[model samples]
Target chain A: DAGVTQSPTHLIKTRGQQVTLRCSPKSGHDTVSWYQQALGQGPQFIFQYYEEEERQRGNFPDRFSGHQFPNYSSELNVNALLLGDSALYLCASRLVGASTYNEQFFGPGTRLTVL
Target chain B: SQQGEEDPQALSIQEGENATMNCSYKTSINNLQWYRQNSGRGLVHLILIRSNEREKHSGRLRVTLDTSKKSSSLLITASRAADTASYFCATGGTGKLIFGQGTTLQVKP
Candidate 1:
């Protein structure tokens, strides 16, 4: 089966510009989550989406938002981007019904460079 | 703030040697998971240990979790050059998973 897939493997934008990254979860999965990982650091949770609604969120600012489609695909949007936003955006997905301990499968991630 | 923090941050080991990485979390969790990333790419799920479970093993990978101490460790046996990667520990209680800073391991041949 095809695993999770993300669009725009690499991107470059200027400060104050908006960017949108897309993700398609693994087949048979429903829940999708987004994370940001700076160079040489662990991923920081941004937000999670289920049933087209955001279920849980991290400490990130309001400039970060996401959407989950019925097909289990997702999109992460960043507004008023800053240089600090230059990092890898990761998308993970799991089946809500799988179990509480179900593991999330991650995509290859999109590398965003804010100049 | 991040919930988990990994120790050592970096490790170098010879091939066939065992490598261990530790992670500590501040809050209670339902489960802990380990993941590996190579060259800043996508993360590959390694193993998962539930809060109640003390230890688990998959292939050459072994995971131990201590709920009382809120810490976990991942052990990779007989490591190889391909095993060189960054390992991260993530805690899950709610829908979202909290990750640690991770350990960068280099296995030399």
Candidate 2:
């Protein structure tokens, strides 16, 4: 089966502009989590979507929001973007209702560069 | 917020040498997982250790967890050049995962 897939492998936007990144979870997986990885830094959890609902979220600002579709796909929306928001957006997929202990498969990630 | 901190942000060793990286988290967790990422690539799951488990092994990898201290370690035995990459430890509690800064390993030939 194919692994997790993220669209628009790379993106560029103005500081105040908004951007939308998409992710398709791995086959048979139903939970999708979004993370932001700054250069030379580990990924910071943004939010998690399960069963088309947000089940958990990190400490990110309200400007960052997400949506999960009935197909188990997900989208991350960032508004009023700041240069600090420029980072690699990673999408990880986990099994439906899988325990947190289970392993998560990650996508190649979408690189967002804000000017 | 970050849940764990990994020591010695970077490490360099020759092939056949063993590489060990440590990670320490802040709160109680249900389990901890280790992931490997090559430059410009996605993270690859290495291993997962439950809070109740002390240690686990897979191929050249060995993981040890100390829930009491909220710490864990990943050991890559007989390292190969292919093992050069960044390693991250993610601590999970409930349904959320908090990651460490990550340790970069350079296994030179």
**Looking at candidate 1, what is the lDDT of residue B58?**
100
- Report the lDDT tens digits of candidate 1 across residue range B1-109: 6787899899999999999999999987888999999999899999988878999999999999989999999999999999999999998655577889999999999
Docking class of 2: medium
Over all chains combined, what TM-score does candidate 1 have?
Answer: 0.97
Name model 2 segments beyond 4 Å from true.
A98-100
RMSD of 2: 1.4
**lDDT (C-alpha) at residue A19 in model 1:** 100
Cα lDDT tens digits for candidate 1, A1-115: 9999999999999999999999999999899999999999999989999999999999999999888888889999999999999999999999887875768899999999999
Q: Chain A TM-score for each candidate, in the given order?
A: 0.98, 0.96
Measured against the native two-chain assembly using Cα atoms, what DockQ does each of the candidate structures obtain, in the order listed? 0.76, 0.68
How do the residues A1-115 of candidate 2 rate in per-residue lDDT, one tens digit apiece? 9999999999999999999999999999999999999999999889999888888989899999999999999999999999999999999998855654567899999999999
